[model samples]
Target: MSSKLFLGHRLRRLRRDHQMSQTDMATSLAISPSYLNHLERNQRPVTATLLLKLAEHYDVDVRAFAAGGGTRTGPDELAEIFSDHLLADLGVPRYELAELAHNSPSVADAVARLYAALKEAGRNPSLASNDDARSVVTPENWVRDYIQQHRNHYPELEEAAETLGGALSDPLSMQEPMRKRLKNAWGITTRVVSQSELGNISQQFDAERQLFLISSQLRPENRTFALAYQLALVEFAGVIDRMVAEAGAPDEGIRQLLHMSLANYAAGAIMMPYGRFLQACEEMRYSIDRLCGEFGANVEQVAHRLTTLSRPGARGVPFFMLRVDPAGNISKRYAGDQFPFSRFGGTCPRWNLHAAFQAAGQVVTQLIETPDGHRYFTVARTIERPIKSDLSGGLLAIGLGCDIVFAHKLHCAEAYDLADAPVTPVGPACSICPRLDCGYRATPPAGRMLAVDRNAKSISPYPFLP
Candidate 1:
């Protein structure tokens, strides 16, 4: 068909989708049926004035309102959402939008909320809408959807952890038997001391001493974690290496660290068998303290393990766990699901992970919303890392957060009044968030132009009609 005919046909399709007849649309546009029909049939073309009115009346992009001169294209929901009057109207930058989509939905959600906030603030001057500030859904997006897609549990680690338990003839002893086994198996020894004397050696193998120094700072849970790491190094190390190799981390520093973390987790599981731990966790009603007590582990270790339940068949509760510093820097992130975390930089200021510090040690529960309308439950608490020497350094204060699905399986969430308790709000950094009205926003929403109103006030920080 001719370009005019194609455009006319597309226009007709859009109008029909909206269930508007030619006469109805003509009446709305203050035009005669004959004229509207001519436009629809490609007998007459749309004028600049008509295009502007169509945009204003239909609340759609004039270009979108127009018919295509060329053939159809691929699925472009992102592109269509871009055409959104709210985004283009705000003058959010294109590169920013592209980055947000590519980076993660958490960032995109943040950007969307920030943009909405800006628009709302400009339209209505009230902080009441500040409630919108907390709608960040990035963490959950990363944890539940993205990370969960990958298997968290490694069978090789599980088998190795269990097998090592057999050789440790004296299971009750913390040091000698475990140490002897290490030396015999991998030329590594296990050492334990007071938390103060633990020093920088959390778990280090000295080839010279043939000793593996494990700080007493390690609680049973941490000891288990350290034990697991050591076991992986000794017994399952090859298997763990194979696992990472299969995962193909591409030989980078961070990837190497991640590989080591995975190895540590596998070894740790050997120290605390998965089936035993899962049963213990369930029997304990997912109580971190009780689990720690029964398994001789630490809270962090338990919480960390909770996230690794992604084994194909024999899985424990899958949880997304993150450790963030007081500064809101995500220090450690493990996705039991697909919740997106920025591959780089700090989380949005609005997230509750930062708020966990205020209530230190107390469990804080939250319900978060994303721009695309994905919702999730989050539970957060502050944890103190054990410190050793005065000269050496102090323990770092960090916050831990887990996705709500696992929270639902936990004892703390069941006891807490989540129904009435205020949920924490969050978003990705302003650079990634699409939110426009964020007073805390460091920059404008991507693709939106900053509109400064002189005469009349806009509800958002920057209001530009697309």
Candidate 2:
């Protein structure tokens, strides 16, 4: 191993010696657990902010965390390439990068590798490599900005959504008030147009005419959500600005995009107020129909809301939410708990996500077992996205599923046998996932060397035992 890799290993060892979990360390530093894992594995470069946080949290001197202090060598350039991209794209002078190498070699190595990968892949491609991306944010400098800036908070929208409560249950009854709010806030009229008039099922804003068109298909819930999304852009522009400002980007455009995406989350939360939504989720037992009726939100909207409750201190059940098309392409994912996820490919085939498609609209349940014997209860069901039929847009069937631990208090527990009943084995995805026997596997795990014992072969291409 290289000096950089050695340094990361030593850092990880030190962290473990302190008896701290990755999540504990990440929470303390206000960084993602995945990023910490990357840094420990020498996959990500360390940053000044992170180094300072570690020093304050662990009460260690700067060199103590680097190679010269009690450690040997760090990783090679390749290892650093795997960290995050933003540090690589810092646009800092080479001398500064070299200075960091001398003082914070672990971080410098990571940033160098990140820049190497970025240069190799050109500037735009995100899936340039398979192993480095995180679930919530793409592996880019802009994503880092999104996270580091706000510490991932949406206080303003949270406050606004709290104030806008109760306008959802009877959208028609509240339409006048909602429309007035939209007009007053955005200077646009919220007009309910026929589905035929809507060129696209989307809620479009005609900036020139100052009119916002809502599809006729929109029920009280859809209308409320659309109105909130609009109001979020206008009423909460400052909040958005603050988020962008705090992101402290290496690039301006990426910073703006991250700002808009997060603003969308704020809008969604506003439509489904966090406190009420959490209460409704527990009360309704997460039944799509029941919760939808009680909260005036759709199934997809409810699932999406469940993923965004990652508010610090007052977090809801941390969930890993994913939506997959019939082809198994993971179009959307949110890692509320930082559970291991694949950025390059699809999820485990044995997961109930694929099975959910077999019976449209019917919820499917499964107990999934990872190779390490970790078990999770999964609930999956297919839902449509609601689009225009003119071939302009049409709803696609996507499966929505969440991890099991959070399902403990859910009423759906009775639906599955959580006992020692054998769980269907699964892997993260084809590339890094270890289940080679899966007919659905598209690739094999890296560095795996299979030895054939002519007479004894397990069902999988790779043996289950050593």
Candidate 3:
């Protein structure tokens, strides 16, 4: 709504792509070339009227830039990427990050992505590719960034899933229909087997026998999801391949990972179609439990699905979902809004996502204010792990949140006084958190000298210069 945008690079690119000089573009827009140069160089911000005119003449969707689209990187993410201890000594200025994000977004995104790969490689050496010619970014991070780049929404996948969802006679019982479709249409039989038979795997498809076997120990929601996943893979195989090809995946490993993740996304979409699910979400006031019941999805599934409701016209609350274990490892993340998520580090100790472990399966609510003074309404709950973040299906918790402005739309937020409610001050992580008074700080803020003293001590374990 505000005209405080610095999208000069985009305008310049548009003009260059159209093979028009500054003078020509300015003449077309009824402005002087000098003024156009100012806008192109980001010396002046574009006004609302100019933006609409550019959209009308050049056919640019101005909303893409406003919605943090066109590129995966943002100024905040650039700031966080440079805040790493590895680059802390460089002391990259804040305005430089802004300039990089605005002027050369593709380069900024590549930098952020490479930094992510470095972190992942440091974390898991076994997964890192030994080939020198190959990309440094891991397949996991590569595919994850691809999903994040699209905001975890694929229009083609959503449409295919809608067709799949239309074939479902009952949403309450999806396993039967998904199984029937897989068997009757694709001639792929579905069987629920024991974990031992599947060798501790959640699922296995025997191509020779045309069999899809799911572990009996797997949750009902997961079984349904697996079936939907299989159906997705079978029905829309070429579409997924084309998507992976378009993504420019470096290797077959990344392509396979993308295929799996995209199939999972499609499965989730099939389980919860866009229009029907969005209507149900509105009618039920975005209640996870009710949506779970209506869609036959688990809490995590419903919460994850909620993040994908970023469709243009029927946009729902822009929520971010985070899955973390007691050890502070973040396994899953979907940021619908700029939630200031730490890239390489764990969540802050002050956040109650970890506290959700105390009451397993019970949803806990909190209104947290970040150091940036942005308030978010968060709901956290514990779920059975069955995940790699914690081996042996140990304790794992997930937190779902949205900007405080949309908090009132949530069913859980109805119990709180949004205006007068007490808000907790939380940071990204102790290593980067600037809060000095907090005793729970495990490490000092980056680039700050610790205020060591012989005769006195501060409340924080890692006291630093203010």
Candidate 4:
């Protein structure tokens, strides 16, 4: 049998948002006021019949109750906050932390803000020289936040790329045009160099020689991208600098990283002009492989470009992209759909993104449902980085997903039953997953006490106390 649902806080919030008193809500749902009060207090579990009635009468999504939709803070963030050394002495349980986040989000936000301030203060270089006092904030985190805040879309860069693309006779085949433009516009000569000459760097510009060198190990498409990226740096330097200034980068390193990201964005835009790409997406139903073939780009490049189609007037489906190495370390992430990515640890092991590593160089698709009951259609594939020698450089798995509401518009979804497909349950991370009976859980969830029964063993390795 299914567990009873206790969404008292969510129901109460909904009632208040609708400006309805307990009696009014009870009357609308055809229930007694006393019964409604009991439900509001969580004394009585929500019944399936009442849930349907509430949805039917109030015109609210049923998921709002199933997932505690009003909760703004994720369970992982709460676990991290409560696990801090400052709060460790309190010994609060994970369930209680989850309750606080769901029932009183404002309090959770205040706590998080205070913790951030404490961390910031601890990072002050003048305050201390100890390693513990060192700042946790890095250029990666700052750049990630900046990109997330912008929803991974830059219209100014898109417009610049569109203009540049229009000037070219063939945008897909960008090698010749990029080379000519680099030489004519900037007096720079482009050349393909051996791996021994390039070393660790994929592309390098020698300012004194006015020469742009690319690693010969890179595929033709990647070499083209390198050239286009260099062109973007030279031509769109002012635009990229303005964007970095607006982001308020912490230091020169972060500013340079942001400039590189903007230059990459410009390169993608140049390869696939925004207007043409959006039309092609609609026509092809967002087929990655076909798009790659059509645009003369690689699978990873095509997937990354899809996430940047958030232009105001011509928006495509909003996607969340994640790239992880074999060790499950997140190397690149961009959230366009507010997808919760664990900040404390690796993503859930059950996600197909990890499974895709087993079948390298192949596309894998899965329908996934998070603990919050939000469903997504995920596509995962392994991408190999260019290597100069026989020694393999690195291989990473890229996952691109969107909310299930857009499943019908995707070619991958054609093989599945959109309405009744079986979804694999996953979470942000094992540290915050609330699924008590999950056999694949690697660690006990935060705030829960493990019940070690010497006499009777359960299927779950770390069964928690009820």
Off by over 4 Å in 3: 1-3, 9-43, 50-64, 67-71, 124-136, 386-391
RMSD of each: 16.9, 10.6, 3.9, 8.8
41-108 in candidate 1: lDDT tens per residue? 66777777777777668754444234221112211223334444555556545555543443343455
Alpha carbon lDDT at 297, candidate 2: 65
lDDT of 3: 0.82
What TM-score would every model get versus the actual structure? 0.60, 0.66, 0.88, 0.76
RMSD of 2: 10.6
* Per-model lDDT: 0.57, 0.60, 0.82, 0.79
lDDT rank, highest first? 3, 4, 2, 1
Please give, for residues 122-187, the per-residue lDDT of candidate 2 as tens digits: 544655665644222334433532342232336566776667654443543435665787777668
lDDT per residue (tens digit) for residues 89-161 in model 3: 8989988998898888779978987788777667767657666534567776677678777777787888888
State in Å the error of residue 224, model 1: 4.9
**Weakest ten-residue segment in model 3 by summed lDDT:** 384-393
List where candidate 1 sits over 4 angstroms from the true fold.
Answer: 1-151, 165-177, 183-188, 192-201, 215-224, 244-259, 390-407, 415-425, 436-439, 454-466
Q: Between prediction 1 and prediction 4, which has the larger TM-score?
A: 4
